[model samples]
Target: MFGPTYVFDDPMTLGPEPSSKIISHAHGITSSASKEEDASQIVIMNLAFNDGKFNGSALSVLGDYPFFQKYKEMAIVGGSGAFRLARGIVTAIIYTYNDTTQNEIIDFHVLVLHY
Candidate 1:
């Protein structure tokens, strides 16, 4: 699903205040887990920032998302616009998930360097 990601200025408050929006695309690929209950997927995500300080910039991520894991780390291989030639790591932790709605809230931490 491609959705709008709201950007918050402060992590502690995590208020309704959003400074910008990011369009995200995440494609899932079949994993090696044989059991149906143990299945997982490899995902690639591209996040394009649309406003505020990060407007026009984009970053790419590739990683494994285990069904039961609460925290995941992905590699940031590249980016565009203000983040051109970026490289770094992105850490994501699951905040809340809903099985019936198939919606989830994740907290992300990124450390990047660009030229």
Candidate 2:
């Protein structure tokens, strides 16, 4: 679960490399994860957004870098606050276990809007 409670320390990284975005919230208050067993597995359960401006830039803090480009063109509906912001927000709970010694993992992004 990703929330305002899971705070990650500075110099964030899986091991020696620098992580793109480290957890920056306190635990058990907003979101919770089981990192004691398999630290690599990240579970983002919910994403909450406060009511305010609706600019595209406001969605930047929703998650980390390399967000899905397709989400920008999508739309969110329903009364639930979660869905209200989900339309423009792109949230992905990724679980990656890369062999750092063999290949360097790379995130690819492509933006396409057919309107």
Query: Pairs clashing in candidate 1?
Result: none
The RMSD (Cα, Å) of candidate 1 is 7.3
Give the per-residue lDDT digits (tens) of candidate 1, residues 1-115.
2222232222211322233343333323333433456445555666666556776787876776666777788888888898899999988787777799976666777898988
Local distance difference test values of all predictions, in order: 0.62, 0.27
**In model 1, which regions exceed 4 Å deviation?**
1-38
lDDT of 1: 0.62
Q: Provide the global lDDT of candidate 2 against the true structure.
A: 0.27
Name the regions of candidate 2 deviating beyond 4 angstroms. Answer: 1-4, 8-30, 33-56, 60-87, 93-115
TM-score per prediction, in order, is 0.68, 0.20
lDDT of 2 by residue, 1-115 (tens): 2222443322222233454543222111113333343222222222222323411111112233322222222122221322333234333332333566532332222122211
Q: What is the number of residue pairs that collide in model 2?
A: 7
User: Deviation in angstroms for 99 in model 1?
Assistant: 2.0
* True-vs-predicted CA distance for residue 65, candidate 1, Å: 1.3
Candidate 1 has its poorest 10 consecutive residues by lDDT at 8-17
